[model samples]
Target: MLWWGKEMNEWQVLHASDLDFLLENSSSPYDYSGDNNESEYCCGTPPCSQDFTFDRTFLPVLYSLLFILGLLGNGAVAAVLLSQKAALSSTDTFLLHLAVADMLLVLTLPLWAVDAAVQWVFGSGLCKVAGALFNINFYAGALLLACISFDRYLSIVHATQLYRRRPQARVTLTCVTVWGLCLLFALPDFIFLAANHDERLSATHCQYSIQQVGHTARALQLVAGFLLPLLVMAYCYARILAVLLLSRGQRRLRAIRVVVVVVVAFTICWTPYHLVVLVDTLMNMGALARNCSQENHVDVAKSITSGLGYMHCCLNPLLYAFVGVKFRERMWQLLIRLGCPEQREHVRQLSRRDSSWSETTEASYSGL
Candidate 1:
């Protein structure tokens, strides 16, 4: 992985046509390549050692914290949403599914944590399952956020009539469609990812078997998982912002804050990772020149940024659900029922204060 000089250039020159073809057909300017699988190869140059000391030290702790925080946050979201006897709003339904997606994503983290600290101890079958689940939920969470944004756009800007009647059915269909798309995106991982021993790393690792398959997977991830959903969110939020701005009130201000916070949080958590991965992808695809130093820099950056990206799963509940008056109220009620009877009056007062902020906002938004 560290040796990227003359031999790497020769390989790039040999595969130049293939790389161009991939770039031409790819959906995003920045695509994902075999960043994860790069350590498996050594150009015909003298064997060079790529240090995984940072990965071993950093990743296990990162994944463990993410798993714990994500599990607790999404678990609370699911529990509160399910406990309610009332019919769910479109936003609520999406939040529930988003929680489920985040939960699924976090559940895979422990296995990955183990993989990072040691080696891929799980066999091939479990590796494939865990990898596929990771990919699916990674995309699903992003797409579901886009769905929430689009739903908000329709309700706030166009005020669509279709959602006014039998909205639950339509929401259900949308969630199903999103999951199906995510499954399709993860299909390559399900088929190709396996636990294999890497000579360079001298450890077993789970990654794509075929380099081309890794390129394809990365392309899909960058395009569909990141870019497509990013576009959808940007457009939806832009329109939602336009409508919110026209209204004159503190509610409008709070709604605007919600829009800003959601977009900013998503961008902050994900953009760096995607950009670093994109560079890795471009190098792998021969779209960019490769050097050992640059590759090593990206290797470390990818680890750091990917950990930041993983943190978004934990942030979802706080950003999308807990910030809302209704959801908070529900959570408080659940807590009170569970064991916080003494705080019931305090919860009611806090709920009433925030609930009065905006009736429409309460119904339309999960968070502010």
Candidate 2:
């Protein structure tokens, strides 16, 4: 199924004119080998994907390393959180889901990395599933960053008792809502992205089919992908920093640094990608410089920035380790439970801090 009946026609006969709006198309028209399947599915010159699909050697290696690191890192984070089970705080709950989302997003990178090295040979089914899954995780991760930041804001900036009241319910509801929105963002992919087989290049690609992409797509992409979460992160971190400033302690200062790092890392990794995509979307809709060089630049930027976005999966686990003292302590305990002797002394030093954090967790997110 094309996921939308009307969108089917565009796939069958995608003239260059139909794709002119999308800077995602290469500066040159996409050319597919002649075949019933190829003609019916993807028909375009490949995007100048070769120019910056990845840095080739280094990127594929990095992607592999990232996949390994992301798996181990996020897995450890999730494992520690799940160990708490019913006793999990709102912060723990958020961290669990964040790890889950990052893991899901990370799982798809191997396929993309393979594509980068050898091109997509997978058929239509994997394409649709992977594309939709990627969209869901990508959007969910972005939204959950906002949700996590808000959860922290409430714990740190608001009254303590008020923050903990039914926190389990609040976290559950927030997660459900975030997944719901992610589904909304993912649905379009089943219709838009599909498998395109080109035996000539010995490659089968998974990409968007040309259709009436313009204002609606641009608006949705802007709001859901870029604007909403950016606002949330900025607002929550700004408030958290402003409030924490009046308090005096190494802990408070550390909290400010963590919050700032969260915002900074997010901006550094995601903002360039979103902005490049946004500019491309605008050009596709005739609202920006629609020149060939400009389109090529946007495409290259999108490719690079997308890699950066994926790198977040690697960064997130480190964030968990660095930002939350409790997380590190818990991780150490988890390691010790698994019989890691090296973490024993480390766990001892963390005890005093852990107790202090536990005591004040009633007042702030120290235990989180």
Candidate 3:
């Protein structure tokens, strides 16, 4: 991974002509090559050069916006989940954890934007800590999503008296297990991240390079970070969908729709990012065959891929706003509470009455 920039130039020696041909045949309106060598041997060019000025200078501005929005949105979700008077069900528990994880992840955006603007100014220790925290949340979010899918499946397709007997204990245990696994997976990131100076660019970067462990570490990270979690999520959702189809209840259908929206939103937001990372990792490991003269083509590709990943930070809030109706309602209630105390009190009274009615109905059913 560390040698991606250097390796691209080497590959260009073997694949320059093919790359030139590709550029010529591309359907894009812009010129693919201006005044650069097309061979893989060339180390620098327009979009590929480390010094390539991003015309999108607004990226940092955009990141700052996302950072603010994500923090507020996820924090609200966490607050609503935490503040609810109802017993903490498995779904609520998982959503709370997911919000916490995403909030932590978004909090690091400003640091990254600063790094991108003026190079990595933070010391080695901070770098490692930041990287570890980011990975911890990343994995935690994935695990929680999978857990949510499985929980939905159980609540619907495999609904049974025993499953609901000790719901609180099960939810607590599952959350603990998720956190433990996230910490374990994040340990390497903590160890490997460090401050490094790029001589060519004259910039300092916070990065993870497993030069000592070589390809093995890269492979492990790819599997753990992308492939394994993806598979687990896919499997759980598939089973959840099957169970939902088999079940016959209005509540089951509503729950299924919520789970489906959550899963679909997650997939849409994360799939491109993971696919790009997987491809870039493969390329870094020399697993991808490339025919290009200039190393810049691959570099440009990487930059674009990274930008795509950064977009995921912003998409999470949209998912919550769109898929999580209860969260949205709570946010509106919070706004009302802040803006009009009398109205808020009236709303609270109505909410208490509704809860009392629900409990009365449950008590009557139990008595029967």
Candidate 1 clash total? 0
Candidate 1 Cα deviation (angstroms), residue 19: 23
lDDT of 3 at 345: 66
Write one digit per residue (lDDT tens) for candidate 3, span 143-181: 787776665545444554223768778778888988998
Q: What is the lDDT of candidate 1?
A: 0.73
lDDT of 1 by residue, 252-292 (tens): 55754554576668878988888887788788777897767
Q: Where does candidate 1 stray beyond 4 Å?
A: 1-48, 255-260, 320-322, 366-368
Candidate 2 Cα outliers beyond 4 Å, as residue runs: 1-59, 160-163, 197-203, 213-219, 253-260, 290-292, 353-358, 366-368
Q: Is 1 or 2 the stronger prediction by lDDT? A: 1
Error of 3 at 301 (Å): 4.2
Where model 3 places Cα greater than 4 Å from the true spot, the runs are: 1-49, 55-59, 160-166, 212-218, 246-251, 291-298, 304-307, 336-368
lDDT of 2 by residue, 1-368 (tens): 11111112223343455555433444434433345635322333233222434345545676788789989999988898887645876666766788898898878878777666666667777877887787788788778778767767776778443336676787788889989988877776766677664333345566655545423544565688668888988898788777777765656656445445765787788877767766766665556645557655765566667778778878877876787677788888888889898999998898775675455542455334
- Highest lDDT model number: 1
Full candidate order by lDDT, most accurate first: 1, 2, 3
TM-score of each: 0.85, 0.78, 0.73
